[model samples]
Every structure is written in C-alpha cells, then in structure tokens.
Target chain A: MGIREKPTRMDQVQSWRADFPVEYLYTTGVAGERFAKTLRERGMLAATRCQRCGVTYLPPRIYCQRCFADLSESWVEVPLQGVIHTYTVVPVRATGEPSQSLEVIAYIRIDGTEGGILGRVAVSPEAVYIGMAVEGVLAPPAERRGAVTDIRYFKPILS
Target chain B: MARKRESSPQNPHDVGRVMREIPERPRGTPLKDQDIREGKVSLIAWKPHLEYRWDSGVAISRFLLGLKEGKILGVRCHSCGRTVTPPRAFCEWCFRPVDEWVELKDTGTVNTFSICYVTWDMKPLEIPQIPAVIEIDGTHPRVGFLHLLGGIGEKDVEAIRRRVRVGMRVQAVWKSPAERVGAITDILYFQPLE
Candidate 1:
C-alpha cells in the first residue's frame, strides 16, 4: 500500500453512473430457418433427422451432435402433440419479482423425436405431471412469426 | 527442384479426394440480412442493459474536485520531476507514489488535433467536431489529455481543419460554476487563444 495523503471527507470522493449498450443481430441457421418458416407458414413443427445416427433434432440443427453428420437435407414435420418430460412451477417473474399467477414451465418431449423443446404449459401446477400428453396451441397462421413463441403454449390433449 | 515431385502420384489422392467429396455433399442454406428483413428467414434479437458506478480514486478524486472549483490540477513526481495533468497517483515510469499537487493554467497548446465527421454513436454529424490533445501550460511537453476544441466559428469540416494546427495556443472554456459537477466535462472545451 502506498501510504499517502488521503482525503478525509467522503465529499472529496467522486463517482459516476454509466450504462453500456450493445446491439447485435443473429441469424437462424439453415435447418433452424426451415423449421421456423415451416412452423410459421403451415402451423406445423419441423425437425431434422441424421441419416447416419438416426437421431432427430428439434429446433433443427444442420449437423448431428453425436456423429457430426450433415442433416441439412433431412428435414421432417413433427407432430404438434408431445409429452411433458419435466416441469417446474415458477411463482415469480424472470426478474425474481412475485407474480399474480404461477406458470408451469416445462420441457416437452415431442413425439417421434428424442430431443425436446421448452414451453409453458397451460395447466394448474398441481394438475400438471410428467408424461402428461400435451398438444401445442399455435397462434393463427397469419399471426405467426418465425419464432418459438408462435406456439403460444402447451395444453392437455383431449382424450 | 526440377527432379523432385511434391508428392508421389500414388498418395496424391489424400487431399484431392476430400476436396472433391466436399462439393457433392449437401451444404447449409445461406441467407443474408436482406432475407431476414424480407421475412424470408428468422432471427433472434436481444439487448441486455447494464448499469454501473465508477469511483474516481485518490488522485483523480482531487483533480475532479479542482475542476468543480474552476481550476485545473496536476500531480508532480519528485523522483522524475515531470508534472502530469489528468493526474494519476503513481509515477508509471518510476513506480513511485506521487502526492504533490500543482495548479496549472487553463490554457494549453494543441499537440495534435482531429476533425470527427461522426458522433461517438457513428451517426453523421452536420458540423464536424474538433478534438485535440492539448498539452496544458506548466506541464511537461507532450504530456496532455484529449479534449474537444471549439469557438473556431466555422461549421464546414475542411475550413475547421485548415484553421486548427498543432502547437496552436488554446484556453479552456469552463462551464458556469453552477453547471459544473466535479467532472472533466466541467471545462466545456478548449478555444484557440487569439
């Protein structure tokens, strides 16, 4: 420590408040673009299958993670219904503030694929359970944007 | 060199085979920013906002306080005998603590200058700004800080560039006492001394 003459009063100290803003753009890749476009235009879920490893990916990827196989040309339409693989009840908002209502956030295991997508389930926290069959409730075709939010939420499938 | 071959013809297939195989394989579809704008593709946009506070420690704290009082302050390193403005607590050369403070004249000479055509945010500016490194009076030569220059009375970029010169004498144009808040900005800018 360099011993030196220091200001005794707190008033002698100075501080500044500042903010840093960074803006950026990210493009959905080849398979991801196809998945978004298909969901947006046709109100259907799209996936890709690796011909070499036979593993399917949701939010379609260009390459298979396991075998590093190119799956660009193996796009497939997945069903709208899936089973809840796991879920948690969030009683607060993302900012950690108390919310008026609880939400059931879950990982949905899509039918005919090993991978899953995260979504909000439209059911009571107590009523929702693992392996519960749920169908995606998509926004109207005209209202759909190429975003995952186009599928508003998942609800229990009718018997 | 005339007799040596880069590789034996039998083994030349190693790299060439892979090069030929790549073109036939299916590749990812490429899209441009135009595609995203035209709604032909999708994108994800995110902006995170963060706020922070910075404390102006020992030397800078005193310097800023002097600015609020309408004075320019600097530190003197006894070991090197060099006075530095926009003062620091330690002599970087000698690695010795600097505690002596000196009051410097607001006037200085421009060591270097630049005419900026755009704002810090990269937006086009109608009247280009003139920023310069002004070597403060009473400080060692070339020991100066960057500050904007003003009062040239010219808005055209070329005219300002023609007028401003290295070694031109300038004086700080301080803000009204009430407007100052112990910040470097207290000195609005440096104006050429007539």
Candidate 2:
C-alpha cells in the first residue's frame, strides 16, 4: 500500500488565467449627421426648435424632449456668439495612449438660447473664465463630412 | 384715444373685441421640392469626423513589479508632505511631482472593506470574494491598498475590521512563479499573521 502527495495549494491559485474580450463600436444617426454637415458648409450654427413650445436645442434632435412632439422640420439658425459658462483644465491622460496632452473642455451658453453646448475650449487653460465670449469656427467646407469636430472648437473672440 | 358709449344690447363675448385693417403682400411663395431636397442633402454632406488620443503612462506597470516581489510601495508628495499608497506620480492636492519612493511593511491592518459579490464588470462573481482596504504599516497612517483577504469567512466580512483591528498583522500570499504577471491580481490575497 502507498500514499500519493497532492500538489501545493499555491499551484491552484497560479493556474487561474483567462482571456477577456473587450471591443467597442459606436455609430451616430442621420439627424446628428445632418447637423454636423450644416456647421461645416456655411460656418453656421443650426439648432432644433420645438414647433409646439419654441424651445431650441444646440445639439439638434428629431423629437422635442419637453413637448414630446416630432421636431423633424422645426430647425433654426443660431448666431455663433456665446458666453463661457464653466470650464476645466484636464492635465492627465485618461487612456494609456501616448498622444494625449493637457487640454481644456468648456461649456458655452449661446446668446438667446436657453441651454448650452459642451466642447473643447480653444484657449489657454490658464486664461479662461465663466463670462468670456466665444465664437464657433467650422473647418473648411471641402474638408467637412459630418461630425462634431467639424467645428474645430469654440474660440474666445476678442471684441 | 376715444371712449365709446354703450348703444346696443350687451353681448357676453363682445367685451374685449376690437377691429383693425390689414394689408397683404402681392404673393407668398412656397419652397419647391428641389430647394428642400437641396437643403437636406447639403446638410448631410457636411458632417465631420472627430479623433483624439490620450496616454496614461507606465506608472501602474512599475507598481505591479514591486508587488510581485512581496514589497509594498508608496509615492511621496514633497509639496503636501505626505505619502500615498497605490503610488501616484503626481500629488492630486498640490499638483506637483511625487518623486520620493517609500517601501511600506507587508503587514497592515484593515481600515475598511467590502465583500464583493460581483465581478469587476458588475456580473455575479464565482466563489464570492472579499475585497479589503488594507492600511499598510509604517508608510502613512491613512494609506491603504485594495486587496482580497483570506483566512476569514464571507459572513465575517462585517466583523473583519473589528477582528483585524487598525494595527493587526497581515502578510501577502503570493501566487506561483509561472503565474507572475505585472498586475495587481498577482497576489492571491493577504492572510492574517498567526
């Protein structure tokens, strides 16, 4: 008669390893696609208006949130001038990639509009404020295809 | 501004009625289908593509190597005069470089901990694991690292902090050499010193 030795407990913990699948793909729809294109073509700002209540939206939508009505044809052209509402200087790289540098993101309240838009603030993070005036600038029409980056960023327009 | 005298029989709806003359333009033109289609097509054709990249750097990789060798590390903040566990290269408070490296004791006490019934991605975890906040000894008073605790029952999670007091002894339980990767998961868990 013979007895056998079982393997050490540490060996069991060491044997645990498995592959993790992590993949992500995101796509935007037609309404948003059209909004981006308009910004690039005429360097114009377009927002969605509720035909029922008359409230305009910066990032245009097909339906009105407050009125719960279809806002397919209720579009309006908004002036580019706006005021900086709030901003932050992001100094750290979020992902482990090498290309990220210190940048600033800001919330801008357009004139005569109820809400605002969130985008990269095209100014030194050091010299930004809550009441600073900003103007939206679009990329050249020939180069635009349909995306938020079409408008490069909101730059402080010194007046 | 002239006031009119009442000369007729009273009507309930006539209290606020007023009449005004109107003028009109020669013609009102409706937008043609070609114009509407042109506007829609022009709008869709102008969309732009946005792209950007960010880098987190090699701080985590270096810290994992220290843990694999059964050592605890802390990053020192010169500006605020404090050491932080799970070493950060920058002091979040002072916004300055944290260059000093301090080795902490393998032994530590549980400050606070939670028994995680779910996995990292919020799915139900197998074999129920206990994730503890281990306050390492001799580096910083409040500094702690998140790790699993062994030699205790899952039901004993609430009592772990009471049983393993603020100054209790603990040690790292390392996985086998073949399983060593530059990751925090390399250490299976911490066990109480008997």
Clashing pairs in 1: none
- lDDT per residue, candidate 1, B66-127, as tens digits? 99999999888888899998889899989988858899999999999988889778999888
Give a tens-digit lDDT track for model 2, residues B1-194: 13355555468686686545653554333445785556543322333343443222334444666666766777777677887778766778998677677777777887766666677678986556767788887766777878888776544446655555545577878787678674577778888886
Q: Give DockQ per model, in order.
A: 0.47, 0.03
Clashes of each: 0, 10
Residues A34-153 of candidate 1: C-alpha lDDT, one tens digit per residue: 888898888888898987788889878878999788787888898788999999999999888998899999999999897888999999998999999999999998898878999899
Report, in order, each candidate's fnat: 0.75, 0.00
- CA deviation > 4 Å runs, candidate 1: A1-8, A157-159, B1-37, B79-81
lDDT value for candidate 1?
0.87
Model 1 captures what fraction of native contacts? 0.75
